[model samples]
Structures are given as structure tokens and as C-alpha cells.
Target: MPRKAPSITHKRSRASKPKVTTGCLTCKVRRIKCDESKPHCNRCLRTGRNCDGYAPPLPRPTAITTQPTSTIAHLPSLSAVLISLPGTPSERHSFHFFLSHTAPQLRGLFESPFWSQHVLQACLREEAIWHAAVALGAVHGRFYAEGGEGGERQMWEGEGFAIKQYVKAISCLTRRGGGERRIDVALMACVLFTCFESLRGHHAPALVHLDNGVNLLLELQSLEKPRNLITQTYPPTPYTPLSALQALLTRLDTQATQLLPSRHTRLHPVSTPPTHYETFISLEEAQRASDELWNYCLYTLQPSYPSPYLHPQPQPSHDDLAHRQASYATALTTYLTTKPPRTAREQQAGHMLRLHTLVATLSLSTTSLPASEDVWDTHTPSFAAIVDLARRIIDLDTDVDIYAPETGRVGLDTGVLGPLYLTALRCRDPMVRREAVELLKKERRREGLWDSTLLAIVAERAVGIEEGGCKSELDTGRISDVDVVFDPEGCRAGVRFLLEGGRGSVEGHRGLVLTTDLPRGQNTY
Candidate 1:
């Protein structure tokens, strides 16, 4: 009022520049500045490229808007504080799930803190690795949400985020101009990608990633061993040996094949058993030697070296089976006596070696027996050994949280299911066979990429078919050929029981047709 004579009208000028706290993925990929417009960025639209939606908004800048004062001198920049904000809330949940649940299952036999310590450290430091870890966590979270309300919807959403993070991680690792050069991290990513594919039942792509990871692992191992460097990009950090990881990968590669005999041949050729198999210094060396012996048995028993049979075949000759069995026995005895099971992993390893030994013994015992009714009788001791070992495996792993078929704890490939399934299939004693089948059905946890449900069904069908074969053949002590066909791609399996040695006539019947689909309301991981 005092200055009413000269009232001044002040108009606020528009801000000189608009804020750009986030950019579109397209713009980020192209390494160009974005206008940060809603829905579509003008720069991407002008460049004739599809505008991928903008990344989630980042925190605002922290430049002082008020007068600088002595009391507010040492506050850190807002960028520094927000840099550690991982991602969206969903992303943070996935990472926490991975840290708490998924990491334990993936540890397998080795309790090394590699996944918990080293891999997590890398994830926090590297964006690409961080995305990959989040992707894997999202995948595992789908399983954790089993049987809950709105679980299917959550699973679907998790799948979407998992795929998005996977793509972003791949993009960051493979960007053309300048991308991540951390080979070790890349290898870890490949393994995570393999696990993702395996969860989705896409074994072919999983195998591709496994192969790539194996190659990268070899490269990294060479670098670490010869140069004493952690990786090409990290020289100052001492290289931690990946022996346990290598073993885990090896087991994963082996489990993908349908049959045990078929699994080992796809990889490297079986090495001859060394002379010092009996004098191993450590449990690891003993396990390696036992594996070589196991491989030898598998290679020797394969229907064909290069072309393995999809269905079961007659056992090999006595001489052939015996030679392999002898080597296996020596390795087994040496391992049991020399390499005491000091840890859970070594105990598991020793149990596995025993199972392998039993399998080889069973095969050798029933070799060329013509599949007569007396086949089971003749292999009584071997079957008993299998039953004993299978029981041991079940008893040893009481830590597993066994749930209903609807929601079971998925686990790493323990090398137990294969042996357990073998026991269920070959052991015809009704009590033993049913017990084995019950174990398989109860152990609903997945092992690595191996679906426990599928294996259990296949084994159940095999046992049922073998048991329900022509009663005439069973009564007359006639021979019959049992063929078990497993199609990993379709998750379909069938068993054919054909009686052959019954009065020189062939009687064939389709015993069981097993086709598996993903559980209802479950998303493809």
C-alpha cells in the first residue's frame, strides 16, 4: 500500500531448461542424451528408432538450493546416496531372496562361500552382474511363491522381470562400443543363464550356455593358474580356485542327458584309470579318481560309443562288464578306506561313489542274462546293495524340507536321483521297489536342472511296467526285454515290456505311457 503509486507486475519466466533425471533404454543403448519426455523420447522418435520406455526415475540432484551455511557443510551429494539404491522395490526383493534362499541351494556339495561372498561382491560392484543376479533371484522367487494366493500372477510378473533383467544384463555385457570385459563375471552370468533356461525346460539353450561357461571357465582357470591373476581385468586380486564350481558344472552337464550311460559320453572321452587310484591324498582326488572309474564303466556299458540308445538295451558281456567292475571296485575300496568323509560334501561324494559301484556291480551281475524271470533273483546281492545305498542317500539328506507335490524345495543335482531311479527300476522286489519309488516321489526337490517330478514318474512307470509284464512269462521263467524310452524335450516317456523266451513266441505290450506337463498355475520360469 505504501508503494501503491508504482505497483510492479512481475511475471515468472519459464525455467531455462527442463529436468532429465532419467533416459529411455533406447537412448541409453545409443549413448545419446534423452529429452526425458513421457512415454516416448523426442530424440528417439526423431532418429526413427523405436523408443523403449524410459528407465525408472532417479533421485533428484543434491546441489544446495539454500544459502551455504557453516552448520550444513559436510553433507554427501544425493547422487552418492542414491547410487546404492539397487532398483525398483521388486528388484530389491528378488536380490534379497537370492541372498537368503537361492544361494544356499546352489552351493551343492561344496560349502565354499564363493556364491555368498565373491559372486555377491561382484554383483554389488558390476551393474551387469547385478542384473544377472537379480534375474536369477526372480526365477527362484517364482518357486518360493508356490501355493500362495495370487502366486500364479506373481510368477508371471516375476518371469517378465527376470527376462527383462536377463536381456539388460546381456546387453550391458555385450554392448558393441564399450562393454563389460569381466570374463569371470561373464562366466557366472552364463551359468545363471543356463539355470534360467533349465528352469524353463529349455535344455538346448541351457546346454549352449553351459558349453560357453565351460569354455570361459577353462580360460579363467588357465589365467589364474599360469598368470596367478584373478581375471584378465583384475590382476591385483588373488585368484580363488574354482575346483568346487568346476565339479558343480561338470555334474550339471552330466545330468542333462536322459540316461546315466548317455550322460558322460557327450562330454570329454573317459580317461583311463590311473595307477595311483588307491593312494589319493585327499577326498577330492579320491572323488575324481572314482569319477574316472565311473566314467570308464559308463563308457564301457554304452550301447554305442558315438550313438547312444534312447531306450534300454541288453547288458554288456561278462568280460567287458567284469573288467570295468573290477576297476570300479578297486577305486571304491581305495576311496572308502583312504578318503574318509570328513565333511558333508565328502560324505555325499563317498555315497555317490558307492552308488556307482553298486550300479556297475548290478550291471555286471545281470549281464547277458537274457532278461529271464530269474534276472532279479540272480542279481539279488546287487539289488540289495542298491537298496542299501539308496537308503543311505535318503537318510543322509534329511536336511531337505520335503513338501507336497504342489510345492517342493528345488535343489542342486545331488547325483542321488539317478542312482535312486536306477534302484527303483532294476530292483524288482516289491517291497524294495515300492520303497525306492516312494523315496523318488517324496524327494520332490529339483536337482540343478533335473526335474524331480519327471524322474520320479519315469521311474515309477518303469517299475510298474516291469512288474506288470505278462504273468505267463513271470510264472514260466521266460525272458522279456524291457525298454524304457525317455524324451527329455517333450517330457514324455514310455516303457515297453516284451516277453521273448516264452515257447519261442514274442509277446509285446505297451506298459506305461508317461507324459508330464508343468504343474497347474505354475509359470514357465
Candidate 2:
């Protein structure tokens, strides 16, 4: 009242707006309030002006260049230009090759993009991951580049680069403690190393790296354990794509475990039934059973006592074998008899399930058979099942290829070669057996380290031994043009070759020798 009487003007106070220091250039130029959303600012979008993109963030000026702590603040940001600095020409070439080819090959027909997305991101921030990725790329490049001029030289060069990077990665990872971020990088590096070795056909090294990666993953997964049931349900923590990677690494573990001697088989948490399964077997359950059956067969075929410092390997009892066989049978029935799959992915899954089922069946039945009986005779039903499954898979793949020629039947280890190899070895009917052999020869690529060419050679050798090939035919290479190919149904009339092929005592032992030599010791199909 006194101010009004004095003719004083009252001004309304105004609240200061938030400074848009980090907004896009367009907004800053326009001098308007900006809600700094990604890709474009709201103010700019509302005004219909072209938005100049965000500037690169500047790192906060710190007196300390390197911090001893492992906190996220101390960790380098993904924006750092040095994070993904380009490598040498060859390295760049290999990495590009990996992005274009190897990455796609690493995934299943229906698998998550863990390798391509999560691992690729981790690789950007970690030196160990970078090395491992480059190493894998180099190995893959060499694999494709084989048989070209200077191929051996190129292979050796790639090997040298891979080994050097591998050693560096191991060193860097070992120096890093179990910090959450560090552990993620370390686990990714370990997995990439495993892939590197598998691509290079060194399975023993691959298994060792797989063990390391799996251990790290288990450690990480355990950390998020809740203090109470309430906490577990109230706030669900965001999940990383690493779990998908862990699943993949677990599978690699299972396969590598089969290659290991019996003493190495332990309780792989990854291979156990998952907590999520309720009424029916999921893909993981099917895979776990398939791998367990395969591992069990390895133990059955080559049982060995542990070192004196460790306990001996446990043998599966007859009841255990029966239970496992029945479980696999049920799973197979469920997968096959289920309603027709609506998607291509579902169709591919069914194919894989059948493949696993047939392989598991063959493994179980063969291992359970009395050692005295002819292996071929005792496992005829299993062989028949495999033949039926293989034919169905081929037909399905044919249909798929006819519709979409680019994606031609999941060649990167769809579990086809293993079952096919076994089928070729055990089936006596040249027609069916040759169909298996024909598949192997045509595939002509590495199914995760089981080289199709190598398998074809071994399968053909076994076929020649089981189907009575003269030593001269084998030695002189005169077995060429031996009509081994035939139609699936047309080859149904069984033609059994005498085990004894008149090459004397040596020839009589050929079957035994070939069987013994079939991926023995550290080797696996």
C-alpha cells in the first residue's frame, strides 16, 4: 500500500530455467529451451528446424590421469575416441571379415545376437577383448583363405598374430581383479579365445578358455543374489546380454568336455536343468540332455580313473542309462509330434531337436550294448532312427533353401555332422550310409571344429573297412568311382559287405583298427 502510494511499480519474480549446456547446436543457436533428447531436441522438433546433432562430449578435466579405483566413474566412457582406434591393415581386414562372415556363422538359426552385439560392445572397451576379437578374425580369415597362393604363409602369419594377441589378452585379464565391469570384459575375452581356438582346430585350448569364461560368468551371476525374498521380487535388476553368451559358452563347454578325458567331466551348472523350465523341456533342456548324453557316452567309451590326488570318475549305472534314454525319447516325441511349426525358426528348431534326439539315442544304445555283440547289429534301430531323422532334415532344409536361397540350412554346426558321421559308420546299407557320406562331403566346412572334410575321410575309411574294401583299393586309391551314392528310399534294400575282405589277417583287423582310430584320445566328432 505504501509502495503503491509512492507510485512504485511491482515486478513479478521469474524462476531461472535449466541451462542447456549439452543441447544440440540448433537449439543453442535458436536460444530456446531444449529438452535434450537423443537424435533431436524437442524444441527443435517442435519448431520444425533441422537439428544439428550433439557435439562429442569432452572428458572432465581431472588432475589424476589414472585412478586406482575400479568405479564406473573412473572407467573410460564409450565415447573415448581411442576406445576403438583402428588397427593395422591386415587386422582391420580380418575384423571386417569377422563382422561380415564369422559373426553370422557364430550364431544359431534362432540364437540371440550375443556375439554380434554385447560381446562386440565389450570388445570396444577392453584391450583383452580387442585382441581376442582380432585373433578370432585372423583365424577365420586364414580358414577361408586356405588353398590360395601363399596360403600356408598366410595361415602361419595369422597364427602368429593370434598367439601374440592371445598371450596379451591372458596377461591383461589375469592382472584385472573381479570388478563387475572388468569381469564382463574378461569373460568376453575368454569366450572369444575359446572361439579362436575352436576355429583354429585346437580344442584343448578352447576348453581351457571355456572353463575360465564359465567360471567368471558363474561368479557374476552369483553376485546379484538377494539378501531376502522381498528384495528379489520388489526390484528386478536390469539384465545384461552376457547371459545369452553364457548359455552359448556352456554349450561350448559341453562339446569340449566330450573331447576331454573322463577325469575332466564335472557338474557343469550350465548343463543342468534350468530353474525356468516348468511343464515341458525348453530348447536349453533339450540341449542339456543331448550334451549330457553325449558326455555320458564319452565316459562310457573311455572310462578312466582320476589322478591319485583326485577321486575316480563316476560310472553311470544301468538304471541311469535307462532313465536318460527314456527322457530323450520323450523329448524327441514331444518335438516331432508337436503341431507343425509356424515359423522358419520353429522349423529349424525342430530339425535341431530331432538331430539331438537321434544322436543321443545312438549314443545311449551303443554304449549300453554288450561289448561282445556286433555293434552294428545291436544298434540297428538307432541307425534306422538316425536315417529317418536325417532324411527329414534334408527335406526340410531343401524346402527352406527353395524359399530363401540365402539362408541355406544353418550350416554352422546345426548338430548335423555328428549324427551323420555316426550314421555313416554304423549303417551297412551303402545307399543310406552313402547318403550320410554324401552329406558330409558336400557340407565341406568346419562344423565348430569338426572339419567336414576330416569327418568325410574318417567316415569313408570306416565305410570301406565295414563294407569290405581290399587293402590295395585303400592303398592304391583305386576305390575311386566306387558307387557309394544312392537315393534315400531306393537304397532301402540292405546290402551287407563281409567284414573279412580276403586281405589276410591284416584285413580282418582293419575294422577294429579303424574303430580304434576313430577320433580317439583328444579327438572328437
Candidate 3:
């Protein structure tokens, strides 16, 4: 009883909480004590060495991983990362510009999380990301300021500040050393660089960066060999945004594939995509799969090997072609089974993907034609559906035209342009093709490497080449088909009118192109 009474009288002692001494990255590396000052420590400032900022890094967990050693500490919050952001007026201006104009333009019609969210967060956490972002913003402002057109080289080459910033971003990544997080940072820089080059009309560099990014990402996706255990990835901060990056890369990859000298895409592309796809978890997933399916379908159309030179590739055996075409049609049918999520934006995206799928499936039927334009006649209903879908898209984007007054609407996503242009170019139904062309003319923006203005012109001219620019039954699929060769390196589009235009001599239509050159390969659209 006496012991219990004494214990009951015991009281807890209260004292101040202990301070964290994890310190700045530089201090930790230098084996020096940090005073734990906010942002930059006084000790670091007094010394000559650069202060790498002072925010406690999230610990890297020893989790089961495809790349265990590649994992790294999580980045600090945007607020913390922003503390180290330079206070230069010009830098602040450009960063703000990127957040405002360029970022929105890069997103296109879809609400891309990669641009609207991940990019901003990554920019704060990584110095490389910040420089690249600022560079794009500055160049974007300069482009529009110079009236968007006219200054291809002037805006691109003359802007030393942006280029300098771009180089600095690369340098920062170089200094970041090795880790999966570092790779992620580098990939982010690649996306920015791709956009930067594309905006500057530097197609070669744009595709180069895009191809490298896509190939690298595809490699990572395919390379992942997960360990089976109690699964865990802590602060998977850098890991998850990759899905968004992949989606973005998918659209960029679609811009031009047939133009690539080697079929080094999707490195080990399956002989056929999965017989089925899971029900899409999101609109982004659906769009990516759709764009990929488009690539597959288009690939199936070509000879196993396509040559950039004038020499024609040997055609696959008729049976081989038939087998490939049948497989593609089945793939398209299977893809349609998986529907997109039902949010407003996703619903619209799903609508576009579904329309393109239907059109692709219907067009697959004509893979083996009887050397006649009449082959497309039976699919007039499907063609009408394509036009209707495109019309709906245009209606939704009424307040926003693909072509903006200043910088112009450029994006990596495959919007209404692909399906609509395909309908106009292939659909013999006068009304359907006319509707498609007209819609394209109104949208008037770039979609990846394909220019709507150029494509619309091509479709209009295709109608001319195929049917005297009309749906008249007299000159149908004349001369069989036309071969359009896009040599980005040569900066020339060679259109060979097959069987010579019946309505007008093929030579007469040679003068059909309205615009002289492409957007200098500096646009996502």
C-alpha cells in the first residue's frame, strides 16, 4: 500500500523538443556541422562552395525493387525547394511565363497531369528542371513577342539566354550523378528540351530528343522485373509520374514513326499487342493505348521494312499481308472492348479514341483492295461516323481554336486531326470528305509532326488528285494510289500521284501546296 501511494505521486517531467541536425546537403557531404538555418545556412554562405539548400531528405527505404540500388531519397516539398530558386528578375519572369502560357499550350486540349502538376513540382525539387523550365518559358515568350511566325532562326538562335539556360540544365543533371531519381530528372529535362526544339522549328533535334526519351522510357517500362514479396516503394515520388511521362512520350512518338530510318521503336514490339487490354483506369491510359494502336495499325500497313530512299520496298506476300491485316483488325476490335473512365474531359477523350478506332477498324477492311477506289464506298457509314465525331470535337473546342492568335496551339496529343484527316483523305463520299477537310481547316494547328494546315491542304489536294477535288463518281481512286514520302532531313514531301490524276493531270496538281515549309519541327502539334 505504501509503495502504490509513492508511485501514484510520481509526475512526468516536461522539456523542450530536441532539434534536428541533419543539416544542408553540402554540409553533410563535407562532414561539417550545420547551424540548421532556413533555406541557406550562414556557414555555407560565408564559405566559397555553393550551398545545395537545406531541407531534410526523405529516407530511401530498402524495398523490393526492379532497380534497388537505383532508388534514392525523396525530394522536399515545393515550398522548401522554392527557397533555393534564384531571385533574378528575368528568371522570375520566365518561370512565371512557363507557368502561365507555355505550360497550357503544351497540354493541348486534354488536361495533362504531367504538364499541369508533375512538371511544376519537379521544377521546384530539381535545379535542372528549373533551368529547363525557365529556358522554355523565355523562348516561348520571345516567339510570341516576335509575332510567332517570322523569327524561326531569329527567335531560336538569337536567344542566347534560353540556350544558355538549357545548357545549364544539362550541366546540373551531369553533376547530379547516378540514381533512378537522377534518371527521372534527366527524362524531365528531355521532355522540356523536346518542346524547346520543337518550338524553335528544329525538327531533327526535337525528334532526336523525343525518340531517345521514348526509347529510354520504353526500356524502363519493359526492363522492370519486379521482385515478388511484401511490395513497397516509399516516397515513390520519382517513380509514379513516369506513367504520365510515358503517356506524353506516346503522343510524341506518334508524331512521326514511318519517317524513322529504323524501326527501333517500342524496341521489341510484340508481333501483336495483347489480345486484350485491361479496362482503362483513366482517360490518359486510353489515349495512350489508342495512339499506340494507331502506330501498330499504321505499321501493319507498311512493308516489313520501309526505305527513306526512292527504291520501293518489296511487298510482303499477299497471305502475309492478309494475316497482318487480320491481326490488326482483331487488335482494334479488342481495344474497343476497354472503355475509358467517365469524367467530362475523359469522356471527350474517349469519344475521340473510339471514333479513331472505328475508323481504323473500317479502314483495315480495305487493306487488300481490288485496285479500285470503289473499295472505300462500302464503308461510307463508318466515314460518316468519323466526320460526326470530329464535328463534335470541333464544337466542344469552339471557344478555343487549334490556332491561337499569338504562339499558336501546339501539343503532343493526337487530337481530332489524325482521324479527321484520314477520313478526308480516304473517304470517297463527297459530303464526308468535305466535312472532314472543313473541320481540319478550322482547327488549323499542328499535331505532332503532322501539320493540320499542310494536312488539310493535302486532303483538299488529295480530293483533287483522286476525284477532281470532289465526290464525283467519274474519277475515283484514279491511278490506284498516291505515295507521299516525308523526308524530314531533306525538308521535302514527295507526293507521287498514282495512275496520274484523272480529273486533272498529276503534274497540274503539283502546284497545289499552299505553305512552303513545316513549322521547322519545333511544335508538338
User: Residue 97 error for model 3, in Å?
Assistant: 2.6
Better of 1 and 2 by lDDT: 1
lDDT of 2 by residue, 315-416 (tens): 557557656666666755665576566654457667777767667665666666654225565565666677677666555553331111111222234467
Better candidate number, 2 or 3, judged by lDDT: 3
Per-residue CA lDDT of model 3 for 431-455, tens digit only, reads 8888888776655355565555555
Worst 10 residues of 2 by lDDT: 1-10
When 1 and 2 are scored with TM-score, the better candidate is: 1
Separate clash counts for every candidate: 1, 0, 11
lDDT of 1 by residue, 1-525 (tens): 010011121222322233233586555433346888977888766645556564333443232121112211232322232334466766765665565456655765444445645556556555666788788888776765542335333543546788898888888678623332545556667767887766654555666788787665545544225454534443234222344456556566655543423243444322355433335465555556555555555545544543231232344455755765576577667757865765444665577667766675666666556745567665655666676776676565532322112334455544566666666666657777777666666554566756545556555555554566434334323223434444345333344434434333422332222223333223222
**Looking at model 3, which ten-residue stretch has the lowest summed lDDT?**
1-10
For model 3 the local lDDT of residue 37 reads 84
Give the best candidate by lDDT.
3
Error at 73, model 2, angstroms? 17
Query: Using Cα atoms with residue i matched to residue i, what is each candidate's TM-score against the true structure?
Result: 0.59, 0.58, 0.60
